[model samples]
Target: MAANRIRVAKDKAELVKSLVASKDTTGPFQTYVEVMVFAAALGVKNKKRVPLGETTKREPSPIPQENFASLGYDLIIKLLGINETKDINILSSREEQDEDKRTQIFEEYANAGLEILQNELRGSVDYSERILLFLSLERDGYPSEKQEFDLRSFL
Candidate 1:
């Protein structure tokens, strides 16, 4: 049986570790799952997908599905698959191939996102501030309602 753990591309392992808060590093997120989820979302937002290469090193380590599943990230996986195939039946099958497809989508997006983040964060010592600024810029770049009532608009 194949292992069911979610993977971080070997090349992006250090980036992942540096983004998560830990005793060794005071990153913005509290856990690896949080960082990866955010990365996956970023990838989805930017419409980028990058396949994993040389993942055998697994520096930050592969995450068990339960970690994200417990936090409801599995829905994001399923949603990505459905979006990619435009078939809701992708969600109904319990076959290993279907599961692998979802996992592949997630990993590719996360890998692409990590690459984007790495470039954006290069030479920056404060990831939290940089990330907030990056997010603000991204928000500003998007067209939205002129009278939108978002509370974040005030901040």
Candidate 2:
């Protein structure tokens, strides 16, 4: 059975479009799929899952499930769903309803992630640099000085 298309938040559609690299633009990602998946990953990392609000009228066009499946991203998506529910049974269910539920979960995360990206990318002239800094912070956290250990107080 064919899976349903993945939808992005309506309010974030413009942000999504602006993030993609096109002849007229110089965004980091190559395609919308990449942008969406990256945003989803960000959502997962930030533990920010939000239900999708009003969607555009086929604007930006919902991506086909096959696009992700073709690139083996479906597994990553499924793993995220399983992780969220803390139930491996989510992997067993193949019903359309189950698929839709999983899709909803993914979309919600993407929506939240997009909101984060918008806030982080705002006022940045270079998206790549801003994104790299964001990733660095997410990975290593803010730099801080280490306190020296002193045992003389115990004496």
Candidate 3:
């Protein structure tokens, strides 16, 4: 028997386009926009698939990894409303070898990503409308099983 499927928004592109066109450049929304743009730019570096239980070796991204870092930094600036010069100086001065600082930065970015997903649910008429964004990503085979589970739990 076929597994039951959940319904999603009818026009995912249109919804995203409307969101991008909106004037609300609030921290959370801006972060959301940045993430959407970033995700669009991301591409799998390899075409081969591994067996279910095996891990594929990490490959260099199609775009330079530094591009993602720059995008992340831009999101941080928008999300925090920080002055670009001061923030860049502060970020550049950080010890790249410091584990704690690295962890903190990762956490901050994770939080911003989560905020974007959460924001979709908040203003939607129904869960399906917002969840379509995620479903579309999943349909494209973006999320791993664990990530999909976590996202479902969040929903």
What are the lDDT scores of the predictions, listed in order? 0.84, 0.83, 0.34
Model 2, poorest ten-residue lDDT window? 1-10
Q: What is the TM-score of each candidate against the true structure?
A: 0.86, 0.85, 0.24
> Model 3, 54-80: lDDT tens per residue?
211221111222443555643442322
Best by TM-score: 1
In the range 1-155, model 2's lDDT, one tens digit per residue, is 22478887788998888889888667888878888899999999889998877776565788887888887688867988788888777676666767766888888888889999999999988887899999999898876668666799699
Rank order by TM-score, top first? Answer: 1, 2, 3
lDDT of 3 at 85: 23
Residue 60 alpha-carbon offset, candidate 3, angstroms: 13
User: How many clashes does each candidate structure show, in the order listed?
Assistant: 0, 0, 0
TM-score of 3: 0.24
Better of 1 and 2 by lDDT: 1
RMSD of 3: 17.4
